[model samples]
Structure formats: C-alpha cells, structure tokens
Target: MLSKKTKYAFHALTYLGKHRDQKTVLIHDISEEYGISHKFLENILLELRKAGILGSKKGKGGGYYLIKEPKDVALSKVIRLLDGPIALLPCVSLNYYEPCAECKSEALCGLNKVMIQVRDEMLNVLENKSLADILDKE
Candidate 1:
C-alpha cells in the first residue's frame, strides 16, 4: 500500500518534471497549486535532493529540478526513495527482508511463495513506469 506521503511525493515530482527546464518554481507556488502543505512538501523535496533525484539552487533564483531526465527515472526508484520497499511482507522484500516472528520455515512457506510473486509483479509494473510516463498523463 502506498502511503499518503509517497503519493504526494509522486504527484509533486510529476508536476515538477512536466515543468522541468522552466523557471524555478517556489514551494509556496507548488503547494498552492497542488493543495499540499509547503513545509511537508519541502521535507519531501529534501529527501529527493538527498537521493540525488533533484537539484536545488539557493539564493536569488532557487527551486527544484530533476537531476536526471524523466525517462531516466524509473517509478520504482522514486517509490523506493519515498516509500521504502515495495513488498508488503518484509520476508519477501529484496532489500528490507526480515522474517516474521511467527514464521518458522521461510524455505517451504506457501505464504513466502505468494509474497515473492506479488513483489515481483509489483516491481515489474513500477519499474516499467517512468517519471516521463507519469508526467505524460497531462
């Protein structure tokens, strides 16, 4: 399940990607246009900046821009940056795997099998969808 924070992050990024190479857009402007809180959006942007997905120039003309083109950024990457692992079950997650306390045999567990398939399918879809695809909706 996607968190509200992750959803908001994607929406903001999509809006920014569509306006890439244009003049810097202020946080207040984006917040007002998107119905998001400026402070919350700024924190989201900070995470993106630390992930190297976005760049910011401070001082006279400062805002946000993609560090890479929309096509170069996979939706999975963005989601992971904001939402962490895509898998619902931590045991099935590739990066953040942790066996549940109740689960004893992960090796032959049917639940693990189902979760693995689910995680793979989720990854395939998200990996195929890029920032370009998201922004192109408009």
Candidate 2:
C-alpha cells in the first residue's frame, strides 16, 4: 500500500511537471487544486526539495518547482524516498534488507523465494516508469 505522503508527493510533482515552464507555483495553489492540506503538502515539498527533486524560491512570486526533468525522475525513487522500501517483507528488501527472525536461511525459505520474484516484477515496472512517462499518458 502506498502511504498518503507518497501519493501527495506524486500529485505535487505531477502538477509541477505539467507546469514546468512556470517560474514557480505557490503551495496554496497546488493544495487548492488537488484538495490536499496545505501544511501536509508543505512538508512533502520540503522533503522533495531536500532530496534535490524540487527547488523553491522565497518572497513574492516564489514557490516550488521541479529541478530535475520529469524523465529523469523515476517512480521508484519517489516511492522509496517517501515510503521507504518497496518490498512487502523486510527479508525481501534490497536496500533495507534484514534477515527474518524465524528464517534460518533465506535461500531455503519458501516465502523468501516467492517474495523475491514479486519484488523483482514490481521493480521492473517502477524503475522503468518515470514522471514523464506518466504525464505523457495523460
């Protein structure tokens, strides 16, 4: 399941990507347009800025903007940034791997084998899909 934060991050980024030519976009505008809470959206945008996915400006006519091209921003990166690991089980996680407490050997575990296949298939789609690909469909 995707977290609300991750969903909101995608919404915000998609909005910015669509309006990339604009100098900046006010948070309130995005919040209002998407019916997202201003405060929550603010935090999401701040995190993205810190991640170097977004850039912001202060003062009059200043707001958030996408720093990287939409094609350069992978869906997997955004999801992982906001929602942590993509794997359903900790043992299956590639970046945040942890041995299962009950499982003696990952190679011998039935669940681990199934989950690895699941994770790989999911990653194939996520890693290949970018913000630009998403927007192009729309």
Candidate 3:
C-alpha cells in the first residue's frame, strides 16, 4: 500500500510538472489546490529538495520547482526515495537486502523465489515509468 506521504508527493510533483514553466509555486497554493495539509506538504517538499528532485527560492517569487526534467525522474526513484525498498520482502530487496532469520538459504526458500519474481515485475513497470509518462496520461 502506498503511504499518504507518497501519494501527496506524487500529487505535488504532478502539479509542478504541469507548471514547469512557472518560476515557483507556493506551498500554500499547492496545499489548497490539492486539499493537502500545508505542514505535511512542506515536509514532503523539503525532503524532495534534499533529494535533488526539487529546488526552492526564499523570497517573494520563490517556491518549489522541479530540478530535473519530468522524464528524467523515474517512478521507481521516487518510490524508493520516499517509501524505501519496493520489494514485498526484505530478503528479496535489491538495495535493502536482509536475510530472513528463519531461512537457512535464500536459494532454497520458496517465499524468496516468489518474491524475487514479484519484485522484478514491479521494477519493470516502476523503472520504466516516469513523471512525464504519467503527465502524458493525464
């Protein structure tokens, strides 16, 4: 399940992507437009900025903006940044791999085998899809 934070981030990013030509967008404006809490949105945007996905200005004409092109930002990168590993099980995680305590061998584990397949399929879609692809759909 996607976290509320991740959903809000997506909404915010989509809004920015749609208005990429604009200099900046105020957090309050984004919150009001999407009915998201201002404080929560602020934190999400800050995180994105730190991740180099967004940039902000401090003064009157300042707000959040996308630092990278929408097509350059993969859905998988966003998901991994905000939600951690995409794999269903830690043992199958590519970046955040952890051996299952009960399992003696990952190669012999039935659950591990199934989870690897699941992770691969999920990655195929996520890694291929970008913010631009989603924006085009809309």
lDDT of 2 at 67: 96
Give Cα-based local distance difference scores for all models. Answer: 0.85, 0.94, 0.92
Relative to the unseen true structure, what is the Cα RMSD of model 1?
Answer: 1.1
- Tens-place lDDT digits, model 2, residues 1-138: 999999999999999999988999999989999999999999999999999999999999899999999999999999999999999889999988999898898888999989999999999999999999989977
The residue ranges of model 1 lying beyond 4 angstroms of the native Cα positions read none
Of candidates 2 and 1, the better by lDDT: 2
lDDT of 1 by residue, 8-124 (tens): 788878878878867666777778888998999999988988988888888777888778888888988878888888998989988788888899899978999998999999988
What is candidate 2's local distance difference test score?
0.94
| Candidate ordering by lDDT (highest first) | 2, 3, 1
After superposition, candidate 2 runs with Cα above 4 Å error: none
**Clash totals for all candidate models:** 0, 0, 0
Clashing pairs in 2: none
